[model samples]
Target: MPKTALLTDLQRLVRAYGVLAGTCDHERAIVGPISREWIASEVEQSVLLSSLPAELFDTQRGKDLLAAELYSDRNVDPRSIDPDTLDLSELCRDRVINSNRIPKLEPQINCAVLVANMLLGVRLYGNHGAGVPEISHDLIVAAMLQDALEKPYVFSALSSAEYEIVDADYIKTWFGPNVAMLSYQIRDALLAFETSSDSVVSSARIANSLAAIFASRLRLTARAAGDSVVSFLGTVRRAEVVKKGLDPDSSFPERPYLARDFELAEAALQLAGVDHYALREPVENTLMIAVKDALEDETKRSRLSGRRGKAVHELHINLPVMEYYVASESSNSLETVHLASFEMMRSLEKGRRKSLSTMVAHAFRISAFAERVLGDALEPLVITLAMLHDVVEDGSAAVTGFDHSLQKIMFRFGAPIAAMVSELTDSSVKTAGAHKARMTYEQPHLISPEDQYNVNRFTELDLRPSDGRQPYTLSGIVIKLLDTVVSLEEGIRDPELMTDWWRHSGARIFWADNMRGSIVHPLIERLVIELKQSRSDPEYALKPHRVNRGRLRAGRALLETTLNHLDMYTTQNLAILSDEYQLDESQREFLIRSFNDPNITEERFSKLVLDELLTEDRLCRAMDLGRVPAKNYVTLYKKSSVPEESSDKTTLLSYRGNALRRKAIRTELGLDTPEGITALSLRHEQVLSMYDQKMSSTELKLPCDTVEMVS
Candidate 1:
């Protein structure tokens, strides 16, 4: 038979078996106990003849192939033959006959049949037709018997039965060139599935699965390493249950695990030598249907429903909410980004207290902003960094020290993530020294000598570079911008923090201006407008007490003088400026000038600094921001308008409820103006974009159903 015809016949046979087994209790029972090997053979001649279309099996050659006894006795009833009860020699008899070679002891036959089936499935379903040779029975039979000649010791260890090892020459001499040539390919798929299965069953190997999964997902190279990425994910799921102080063997009600299965299936398929990218849409569609059915069943059982609300009320860190947030925010992000979000959340759970929700929200907001602004071209690097940007900096040093945390990130995630995080972390003693000197000069009473010593020691950890701070990568700069934007938003939403937020915003805006002409420039432009608008709001005006006003004026004066006199905006230069202005005649002159000026109102100073002093080209040169290469910046501004109302009533209701809550909060904060409403609407649109991306990516619609269930 031709290759296509043969594959079509085989696929029909498997599909027919699936349908028949679903309806027939006896067939189902027989399939339930045996391994995948016996199940492959379970597409018996009778099932083929009865279940498949008559035209498919009408040919005598097809019937002959299906009805061939091969090494097994044709007269025997398959229903009566118990695979578990069969002798090892009896299992090896087929391999012996197929290979036409006899070793001193029989080689193991554990994965031979399953590996053959998997290879055949890959040929049938994968996109290997253009350059691949035609399939033949010799190749199929070789695949089936390949495992018996290779991996003899592995099988012996697995089954606790002695087996003689066979060499490549034996395979070539006994089974011909096909088996010898294809044995390695068979071994790759075999070991991938085998190791994955082993990880699922063996307690000793469970801890290593997370690292394996992380490496596989990051590099897409775990297939050759004998690790099934999907299986590791499953093992990690169970491990998470254990971490939650629950029994690993017990059932856990969660949808993220199911969603992750769908999400990671493509990676698994790719590892198994399937052309997952080419088949992604169809494969995801099929898996989505299966998952939706599973979700319906879980919903009927009340397993997925109502749990989020209960968990929210009872748990400090509502995992379902967190998972939903991360999934939605990372829906359009890369696999690495998605994985990093989970890792960051796991790390945060160890050290964070009441600030857990705030931190998580902030991280996810940064991730969301990354996807919206940068798109997916640089998503893997930028989004991963965005998610983990604060793991070392914000985590409690007692729970996980800075080095330990950073090394763990490097080990689990990769060096690039750790490096970017280190760059982003404010861990340099040099930076601390600069901050300390500036603070001492600006407000000497605030930092006692002991506090200054602590700051110095904190910076001495050397988590970052030793010589000086390395310039930020374009990704690091984008993360910093997003972080600032999120902080500014938080400040805008909370009236009590307005004055402090304004001060911080001023510094950050200057930092942003110094980064003009980079990919983050557009974002900076938007931020400047928002800051200007927010600063103009009389409700959120800087109305500090007299003492704080004096301090603010002095700080502004110090900042302006430093910017005016400094040649380059490096930390070294800033430190020198602070020292010189503190000790020299310039110190008294600066203090006198700052206190003497009455026209430098907060608004006028901001206008002068933002509009006059810090033009784009000037600060860009002063800071040498263009030293780092710039990438094309993308924006979703047009896409940020409110999305069309979802056809899903449940989702629409949830969106409206969310909008109402946001409106209520803004109203309470006295920020319910037209611009505020428009900004919130844009945010609402951004969330819907994430929601849509997540729905498409996972191909699972649990969110709409989840909302209905929670309600």
Candidate 2:
């Protein structure tokens, strides 16, 4: 609602137009309050509308004897209030900021909303009138891309479609399907290479790989600045991480680095509007050789190769890297961006090194740390996938082509990393709108959980053979969730907003929208939220779990995120059955004779599997008593919160439903988990064994619980 000041301003403007008296007459006479209620209503509205909040309204406070405040014995003080300054007509209309529904849509869906907004708000919903441009395919595509890239800024600052309409005109039509003209641009870029190291890529073949993919994305995102692109690529080349002649050096200038770079430039032009396939090898190989020969590596040439695949992706911006660099004049804004990003990643600062040689080393270390943590709760290959999650964003990518950056990251890590990188690098994930990105990312196909578990998803991007028996495994499910958790933990700002965005999109797959209503949320949401808050804002001081600020309370706050009882039951119940059925050392001797019979269900085998996770007996009862120990500190407490004791607690009795979760979990672990799921558990030797074999989710879980013997 507009503040009373806004309404007052509107009315003041009306009065300035000599309509105040006229409006007053119209209100008192023809539109006169017919009933006592009507008169009372308008009078009360006049009074309430007069009071505006602080963010709005400036000076001058008086009714000026314009509209008299009438009281209706109707108790006006603590009730509904009317907007004073704004016109009643505009009051009911939705504000542009909150009017749109892009948050609820996927990339395809929200693009329509953006287009519509441009058509309406830009075209006719503006002060000047008819600002909308003629709709064209190129216009749609560019607008869609712009929506993805600048959506956060747009939603935050500009609301009128006209703002985008104005910006769209400057989208630089230099590189699209129109190629004949881009030849000049290419020639211009090639010219930059002629003079120095800019022309030649330095180092092992990886340089060539970086150059190749970068050229590809560059050609696709022709808007990239040639100079910035050169600098960024040059940065990678100068790092000297690879071996051989491919390294960057003064001798083999960037310009003469093989005919393939020029060829790739052409290929990029051909593949414009061709959704995927960002990187191809033959072209990459040529570029690698050229860049390699240009290198000045003091050491032996690297055995590492450039990323290999037919996968293509696109990225463009106002930086100096691509053909058209966008140097927004406000140098201050750029610093703010850097500052924000730096602050958001402060969680990683603790592990950083003081020396120069160890920066990348530190990154690898953190990656290893995340890997180890997830490994404990999940399978091994999946941990690698998680590590590769941030490799692309780490600044090594030169963006030579579509998905060039991601390809470079994959290449840097090798095949296993490449596979996981493939799954994590979705064009859908890089949305202009934060919520749009969330929607696409949360899609069942794109990602499983929140971004908090990014490393979890990275390892599982590719396929490994599934175990023949059961559908899914906990490791598989956890990876997806882990991927989500990592993303959310790092980039997301508002937890409430994050949850809302998740609900809007994740609802289809997750069913229960709010975290408080789910099993997983109760188990993990607090940690994620605390981590996110602590990292996002400097003021938020996060403490280890045992050190929570307050003492235990009655009906205390549990977890902001809670999974549904049914889902929890299914996952826990199945795990319990597997636990009891798989490991019976006493039955080992009998197993030789009973080899003819398969593993029996717990109920049929004279053993009952009770879930340690569920609260029925001692442990659960203690937990119910609010005397559970904190996860990080192991400190015990009581009376955490005495809920008014609602009838909400349900005993896990005769009920079952995990067919879908199991299906998704298994599919993810076998195919998506990196290195493939041969085994499950945190034990090092066992983990190494699992990494070597491709086991079905059931086979992995079989030994995990049901089968305890060697032969």
Which candidate leads the pack in TM-score? 1
Assess every candidate by TM-score. Answer: 0.26, 0.21
Candidate 1 regions off by >4 Å?
1-333, 350-356, 376-378, 399-403, 428-467, 495-711
lDDT of 1: 0.32
lDDT of 1 by residue, 1-711 (tens): 111222322222222111121112111110112222222121101111122222222222212222333323466433243334434334333321110000000011212222232233333433433321233334444444432443332211112244334456645543455545655454454455445633222211111122122212211111101111111122323343345443423232333444344344434444432333223333333333334444455332221111121111112122122222232223323434434654564344222111112343456555544433442222356556766887776553322222236766655554445655775665545353233222222331222112222222332434452113333433444565566555434322221211211212222223323222122333223323333344465653453211133332322222222221111112122222222222233443342233223444445533443244323344234224432111110010111223332111222122223223333433443545687457544543433333234223331111110001111
lDDT per residue as tens, model 2, 225-294:
1111111121222232123233333332223332334444434323322111222333334333333332
Worst 10 residues of 2 by lDDT: 98-107
lDDT winner: 1
Against the true structure, candidate 2 has what lDDT? Answer: 0.25
| TM-score of model 1 (CA atoms) | 0.26
Looking at model 1, which ten-residue stretch has the lowest summed lDDT?
98-107
Candidate 1 contains a number of clashing pairs equal to: 0
